[model samples]
Target: MRDTVIYAHRGLNHAAPENTLAAFAAASRSGVTWIETDTDILADGTAVIMHDSRTDRTTNRSGSIYDLTTSDLDTIDAGSWFSGDFVGERVPTLRELVSFLGPHDLNLNLELKGNTQGRDRSIRLVETVLEELRRLRPGTRVLISSFSPLLLAEVHRRTDAYELAWLVDKGTIGEDWRSVMELCGATALHPSTAVVSNRCVVEEIRRAGFGVNVWTVNSVQEANKLVNWGCTGIITDIADQMVEAGRRR
Candidate 1:
């Protein structure tokens, strides 16, 4: 079997606040070469790394990302809620993340959060992300993913420079994943673990010339199963343990 890649989900969120620079550093220290993070834009059009539309869950302050400016976001303490060791950890901008990952041989799976405002905003967000990435070191590998077909399709239409993946849940696009991939022109599939439970499904995705990267797989047993079934990668919170598991396999 080929070596199964382990992507630190939100940069080892269990060690530090999710999507924070501290968390990303922790993941890299644990020897994880691939990391996954979510993206959202601020009021001033600065692309920041955050999973939620609202900052209430992750920061010391409460407000929607769209309602907050880059200056406003910089003031929030994003790490205290997770632990005392990571107090005052600021949420990073996409440009900051690109610079941070540029020196390392890391592959970033950036999931573009949906823009419900309008198609123009969505296009702008994608453009902003690409611009930041361009400023980084050459040959940085990035895979863009989204549940928003509109945004993903817009990105695909705009640039063939980056690889795109269509994110799917079991309830939505479980059986019809191929159609979603085709719709978005995705080169890979980021499906919830529930959808890839059947080994044949993994084989099917591989046969169709797409990589299957399963998300949120935490247990060693589950990780081993996915790896044995020919999954390309496992996105997980426990990068250290998963790395050990991959080594054992």
Candidate 2:
């Protein structure tokens, strides 16, 4: 009800390939001004939009994202897996996504993927993402979330230019939600829908002075329930439905 924003989770993946430009465009067309996407670095230290460490699930290529350079990533077909309608779509760099969303006044929820390679690589991921945000879209509202405390801490250490949110599961928030938030210097919490579907927990998180944005909420009933409960944001795969649900409140 009260300005509960609907963020398109992975850019409405039900309609297009996840994390691709095609998916982002589809979400925008569906009247979504907020989109959530994953960010991982390539071998060349280029920040790119991708959900998985490997390309097998989303693209025609076969290799770990960290092993591939930006050129290697661009050569693969990223859209065909979802449908032929998105045939020629290539993987987009974070810079590309930022440039695309900046002028449109669209907000982004960029999830930072952990560097499976090592600690140095993880620090680099944080640096690369922050540098992109500072350079490409300085004035834009971007919320950065991650389950990795190391990564979030790295981000917090480098810059506080953007809002940071700690992503947590049911067990992770048991009695230490505030502690976790303080540890990462995060002002927000991105809890799994399975964990936060309980209205009491949502109230608890809000009472702790942390904004709650639940993830992957797709159904209108669920969306309405959360919005009515005064959740700050709902990350959904069905942005249109959730937007309508928010309006109904």
Give per-model TM-scores. 0.95, 0.94
lDDT of 1 by residue, 1-249 (tens): 127878899998898899988888888888888899999788788999999998899999886888888888668999899989888899899988998996766779999998765767777898898888887677778899998876888888878888898888887675667887888889888889988879998999999999999998989788888888889989899988888766665
Minimal lDDT window, size 10, model 1: 171-180
Q: What is the TM-score (0 to 1) of candidate 2?
A: 0.94
Deviation in angstroms for 74 in model 2? 3.1
**Candidate 1 Cα misplacement greater than 4 A, ranges:** 174-176
Off by over 4 Å in 2: none
Query: How does residue 63 of candidate 2 score in lDDT?
Result: 76
TM-score of 1: 0.95
Clashing pairs in 1: none
Model 2 agreement with the true structure over 1-249: per-residue lDDT tens digits: 438878999997889998888788888887788899999898889999999999999999987988898778658999888899988789999989988887666789999997788988888888888778875555668889998866787788878887899988877766766886888889999988878867898898888898988887878788778877768988888887777665666
Residue-pair clashes per candidate, as listed?
0, 0
